[model samples]
Target: MIDIKNLHKSYHMGKNSLHVLKGINFSVSEGEMVSIMGSSGSGKSTLLNILGILDEADEGTYTLDGTLIKNLNEKVAARYRNQFLGFIFQSFNLINYKSALDNVSMPLYYQGVKRNVRTEKAMHYLEKVGLADWASHLPNELSGGQKQRVAIARALASDPKLLLADEPTGALDTKTSYEVMELIQGINDEGKTILIVTHEDDIAHMTKRIVNLKDGLIIDDSKVTQVRAKAENYV
Candidate 1:
């Protein structure tokens, strides 16, 4: 559902320009689970930002589900982001004062969904992430894993076409990380397209495909033997 060709990005600091992405090209089909891997200074984050429409590429083209993503006005960009992309960050990004249910429903609220419908959909996704019983808890009241689960529920509340996860398990322990990956795998199995940016090899292996980046270039892009995440096996 994502197509990119000759994508280039750079940042200017004083007289020098730092190139972040250089002539990148790749395509991710619907229902594919892909992970982006790179060491420090790689263009993975920049690529993710461009894919999420959080940043613009200096050159080349990015077409998300057939729409050319280039120089979108803020209103149109926000609309496309809300309608087509769902984001999961290493930092859960939940509201501290908002309960899990409220956090999950916030996106729907912004979309102008009715209060009842928003609550209904939020709870449905919370249940899907196995957080139905913890809906009343605030982010601070939950553990790291629980908070991420709530965040996942929030991401899914919009039912967006693509999910972008940036180091989704970075803040969790190994067991918790595997648990979360298991949940993510199940989501992908249901036909949701997911693109994850992570530095961890084991985590990348959990995905169906891995794209390796170095010095702003995609050095390797290949399908992998997907490793099923079983939380119990980690310990």
Candidate 2:
């Protein structure tokens, strides 16, 4: 679903230039779950930003879901992002004042879905993430795991082709992280392509493939027997 080759990215700070991604290359097929692992200052975040079309690369090619991605104006980029990509962030970026159901339905509202249809779809996804009963609660009233579940439901409400999660379990305890990964695994099993950017080794292991990055390049890319995260086992 994603094909990137010779991608290069750099940032200019006054007269100094810092190269973030150096000729990165990778492809992810539909129904595959992959993790990008790296330490601080690695190019994982740069690569992900490029993949999400949040930032443009300095050079090279990125083809997502078969369309070449480059030089998109902000409006076009926003359109593609809404149509094809779903994002989950470390911060669980939910509206603080909105109820869980309203948060989940916000994306659909932006997409111009009718109010009733959007609410129905949002509730369905909230139920999928085991948060149906919590739909009326605000983010402040929910636990970290509950908030993240609502965020995941928000991401899924649009039925995008790819899901990009940046440190999805970063804020939670170990048991909660495991529960979240278990939910993510079930999503992948249903044929959704996912890419997780995480520094945690255990988190990377939960994915079917791990791609190691260092000094702006991919050092290792290999498939492994997936480690299933069972909430019960963690508890």
Q: State the C-alpha lDDT per candidate.
A: 0.96, 0.94
| lDDT of the structure predicted as candidate 2 | 0.94
- Candidate 2 structure quality by residue, lDDT tens digits, 1-235: 9999999999999999999999998999999999999998999988899999999999899998999998899999999999899999999999999999999999899899999999999999999999999999999999999999999999999999999999999999999999999999999999999999998899899999999999999999999889999878765
For candidate 2, list the clashing residue pairs, or say none.
Answer: none
Stretches of candidate 1 off by over 4 Å are: none
Candidate 2 residue spans exceeding 4 A from truth: none
Please give the range of 10 consecutive residues that has the lowest summed lDDT in model 1.
226-235
Q: Which lDDT value does model 2 have at 60? A: 91
lDDT of 1: 0.96
RMSD values for the candidates in order, in angstroms, are 0.7, 0.7
